[model samples]
Target: MNIFNRFIVTALLVLFTSKAFATSPIITKIERINVNTILVTFDQGIKPVSHFDVPIEGEFSVKLYTSTTYYLGSPNSLIVRTPTAVNPNDNGFATQWQWEEPTLTATDNDGLSEITINLNAYHSDFENDIGHSSLDYINTLNLIWQHDLSITSINTLDTNEGTNLEHTLIASDTAATFSIIENTSGLFSLSGANNATLSFDGTNTDYESTTKSYTVKIKATTGNDTNENTEQTLTVNIKDVTDTAPVIRRFTISQGVNQGRLIIKTDTSVTVYAEASGGSSYTWSSSDFSVIGSGAFVTFIPNADVGTRTIKLKVTIGDYSSERVLKLKLVESHPTDWKDKNNNGINDSKEIGRHNNELLVGENKKITSPINTRLLLGIMSEDTAHLTLAQMKKYRTDNNLSDNTEDTLTTGDIYNYVVENFSATATTQVIIELTSPIPANAILRKYSPATGWANFVINDNNIQSKTSNTCTDDTHWQTGLTTGATCLKLTIKDGSENDTDGDQNNGKGQVNGVVESTISIAIPAASNSNNNNNSGGGCVYNPNAPARFDMGFILLMTLSAYYLIRRRRCFNH
Candidate 1:
């Protein structure tokens, strides 16, 4: 145990301790630049654990200093390494490798002692950068962005007034916004709202066309207006909806038209149509339900109670509607032979009543007036029908007519008195059967001295026609009457079609023109019974006789009847 042996052991121990300190590197401080980048500062210099030149960028790992256990960065972030400036010695020991990483921006003064490293500049080539590490990076920290964002067009936006459209814009900054820059027409409004809300304002469809789109340019910033920013595209879409209101231009009556008014008759169907713009639906109604209409290009029907009516039609298009009105009326009809002298559709002779009102037939409603004497008389008579008995006397005195002492002036009495006093001829009606049945809409009419071209009720649907010749008691009139001899012109027309009343000859038929077969009628006739004989009183009257022979057999019948009675009495005795 000499002093020389103890010195050898001490020297070996000192050598081992120095080697241990050189191999280990201690990291002291780290500064975060952003989410994926940091600056790592170290307390001592470090030498790379390994160095290799790779042909391709692939999976590999490296450490700043060789150690049995510790690593400074995430292993997943390391892939490959670059060759160092100071290569390892033959014994795998070297002071450090040359630091030359483009991302690893650092400064070194005293070799391997201290350095500034930027982790954002960290690539596999930055390994063993051979520079001293320190805390200088804490003074300079900045954010850099490399992310991209954009916008897509929005389609098929809808609204009742037009097209209202909205587009969702996405970005990486704290907020999103849009501004119109690429739009040439300036027709679009790009609103930049800042609440990170789902919808934006200042954009509407009212001013835009239905099928057009506009583009916008926008600048997005990250948190602040710093150098970190991105440029994006924006699209705005707008559409047009139905906006036109309906308009009624013209009105048409489908049937029962007389003058400007609808002449509703017995037929169940009568329609009114309004030619309009943008009409999709229709609503029809009458002042009274007696005439009701339904649907677009509506149809209407009359009820049994006859009078004037106003029919209304409403048409709609989109959100707007329009209405139109028309006037209609129902007038009483007479048989083909009744005379309505003034075309009033009322028998002229029936207008001779005393009225509750002061109107008289021959005065204001003058009997000689050319306009419409029959209509005036009908109005006068109808007015007086409701009068009290006391009022009738005063009306008679005002008109210079006979006073009626009866309790009331009935319609029958007024008409009968006028007929008896007037020179107009009353008709003797006969039923003339036809082969075909007339349509319900068919019109039965007659134009003769007894009737001035008016409507009639065709009994049994075209089976009978009234005659002009008056008759009484005699049911059978011999069938050999000449053409036009009776002067009774009858007609049947389908008024629903284009048939017109041109004077009285439109569909006229005379005594010879009518009568497909012999027939009889029950309508009462005027006086002068058995008047069918143009051969004067020669048509012998016999209460009952054979089809041919007349009163000439009456004498022989009388004589035979007397003999039969006598023979019966004698046989009984």
Candidate 2:
């Protein structure tokens, strides 16, 4: 061997070792810069030779860094892009880069020997930094809303209050909360889960004269992250409803007399009713609380004073109201047809028991003795009579009384009565006194279970009347019997003296015999004739016979007048 050959071999070995050491890159640190990017810092300036080798899982680019010259004469960093979003939980990612990656290669600026880094020296540090990749979102994280947050429904509601509107919001984050950002007139509020409710407070409902609609702005957010929230505006409309006024129909009195004007005595309470429509509430008021009560039906009680009282009733519906006033008269005493001859307030004849059995007729069109001990009389229509006819027949049948075969009594208000505690003998008598004279068109009849209905027989001499006469003093003889003849007097002569009923006890009173009498006053329909049939008395009391006789007389008169006119014309010719 030659000395030159050994020296050359030693020199070649030293040169190759120096070149390998110079090309190797020493990594100082490895870190993640973004969700898809990684940064590696070296001990010296470096240049790219081969792209980074990454796991083939998704779309990726291997040419993350490509340079022919050093960066600023000393490139010490390398930036690598990931195939996809890096999963912070993947601990084997650095393992792949230290062992599986092979294509990634780099060299010095002189392009000497190629070198490949193991990357295992930076495994712990790189993995720790990659686990916090979500922190890279500090600069570019954005919120994405899912829906438009618009409500699409008929928002108009009637002026009637208590209406609701609902709307839902969707955000990329499910933990978002909705809130009302701006409310017009403070009329709208948000509530319920997720603040999905949009409610309107019904304070004012007048749409025609006030604001008709409202607007509000809503926002959805998660905590204080304003960048990840959304906002929307909502509107609600109102509709107007027509308002109508209430009406009062009529007023009626349940007690006292209603002769165009109401008349009542002290200690008498009359129930007054105000019939109305289209109202929501009823209120009654009076200056004197003691004289009237409240509501649609009020009790009017007269005090110990004689005069008039005013009561008012008001019906209200919403904003509309109607009112009515009533004037009632109060009296101190009852009306009677007796005379106070001794200057005392009491009737002298009444004190002596002469008029004790007499009954004063009331405006209810009824007259009766105390507790119906003697008589009960009332005036009613044919319909009312029919309603009571069944009861009357039942009573007769139950009491074993004779059957009624009488013709039906018709026209006017039928006056019915039962006489009790009276004798059927000629020694007993009854008198029917009226406030006004009996009309000439009226006729009196008696209905008996045994004899049916017939003209009531009476003594004309005992009859009395009063026509258009006023009694100022107690001695005027009430009914003006001296002025006309409106008072009818009935006398009983045998057991059959107008004994129309066979009750024996006469309803609920003292019983004098095994049989009693019932009286009825009936008027002939559309007739003004007097009946001539009589039983024992001379008084003729037929109300239907006059029409036929008058018609015949009228025909004869008309013919006679025609004949006279023709004869007179012939003589003139």
Candidate 3:
């Protein structure tokens, strides 16, 4: 070993160590050099013969300085060399490198970082240098990298942008409200979501006076990892919502009687209106409240019960609707024959009664004899006769009469008496005295017999005696004969009577006759001895021929004869 040989070997070893140290980069301390620039220093003590030589050491340390702005790259990383000897000269050598990320240095006065690096300039150089590094060398090197990142933010809205109409309108002066919304597309969140306000500026200055354009500004925040400021402007064009209620001025409907045609008129173009809201078209409804027509104008046909119906007009525009109540007053084509005379709206019994009085002819005719007369006598002919006493009494009992006295006769009782007593024989004449003035065309027939069966022949002027030409006073005599005879008879013929009375006359042979008579006759006594043995013997008088007698005179004679017989019997006793 010569001195020259030793010096050459030592120089080679030193040179190899310095190269190795240069190839292997390490970070011993990290420092903020500036806001935008980062500086790195390496130790030159250990050197490798070539860039591919392997170093005996596993770890190394270096110093790193950072700025606010820096480029993140691989070429700037330092690593150990591999596949090379300790000799200074080696052709096949490889070097390994790693990246060292640096921290940003913030300025004291301002929160912003002042130093920055041209990332685009150093990006390719750094990738080419450190990307070919070995695993062990790259892992042993300590290096720092830095990069600048950016965040984007946006604002969003949860509600839609439109006007909200709350009230229905009848006139055109109604006001509407609109809400301004910010649409963020779900990218960001608003700071005061509910407190965001909308300012309006337009022709309608009463709402807002800033004429620049209506807009809604939103204050928003983004992700929590980054401080981001976001804002969005919502262009608000407050369209006329027609929120002003449609003026339905002078809405009226004229209808004819019996559900005739109804003509409707309104001051507005939308003639038909209703109670419902939000219909672009109007639905004209009838009494049933059905949609008959869907348009601006409509015609409604009423039903039978809906004579004069009050139709409701409903008109809807967009989300808002309006209604105008119109009256469809009916007009009568002709006056009703029966009206509510009692002033009540309904045609009740009292109204019907009044109408009957006005329209019916025999409504006023009633019986006068009884206290409360309601009986009406309608005589068809003049040859009518009075009833017998027994028949009259039977009729009264059958008709629920309380007593047999003739003084208290109800209208019904009087009518029954007249009907039962009178015989429809001939054209009988009758005179009626009414309790009140009779209505027109009333028929009355009632009479009293003053003489012999009251033989009457219905004449045009009065009822006269058929056989007797006696001048009978018939003024107070409703119907009676003036002549006295055994029997009274009435004759009726189908011929017009040309007499003194102004009574209606019809055809001939329609008259009937009734007879009343009294005669003196004898009835034979019973011839049985057993019946005679029960009574004492008395003389029985028998008449030889029929003889007419006065009933009063016969009655007197019979009473006198009985008295004389009694007196004689008393004397014998």
Could you say which candidate leads in lDDT? 2
Off by over 4 Å in 1: 1-149, 153-166, 170-245, 249-264, 271-283, 288-297, 304-309, 315-321, 327-573
Off by over 4 Å in 3: 1-11, 19-241, 245-284, 288-313, 316-573
How do these models rank on TM-score, best leading?
A: 1, 2, 3
Alpha-carbon TM-score of each model against the true structure: 0.24, 0.23, 0.19
User: lDDT of each prediction vs. the true structure?
Assistant: 0.36, 0.44, 0.30
RMSD to true structure for each model, in Å:
28.1, 29.1, 38.7
Candidate 2 lDDT (Cα, 0 to 1): 0.44
Model 2 agreement with the true structure over 51-159: per-residue lDDT tens digits: 2453323211222222454321124543233332222223333212211122222223334332222222221222222121111110111112134323333334343
After superposition, the stretches of candidate 2 with alpha carbons farther than 4 Å from their true spots are 1-373, 376-409, 422-426, 433-437, 460-463, 467-487, 501-515, 528-573
Q: Write the per-residue lDDT of candidate 3 for residues 357-444, one digit (tens) a residue.
A: 1211123321122221111111111111122344444533544444332311111112111211122232332222222222222222
Q: Compared with the true structure, what per-residue lDDT tens digits does model 1 show for residues 194-305?
A: 5222232324445345435555555555444444555555555544544544544445554443322334456656665555655678777776544444554666565545
Order of candidates by lDDT, top first?
Answer: 2, 1, 3
Residue 194, model 2, lDDT: 79
By summed lDDT, the worst window of 10 consecutive residues in model 1 runs over: 415-424
Report the C-alpha displacement of residue 22, candidate 3, in angstroms.
5.9
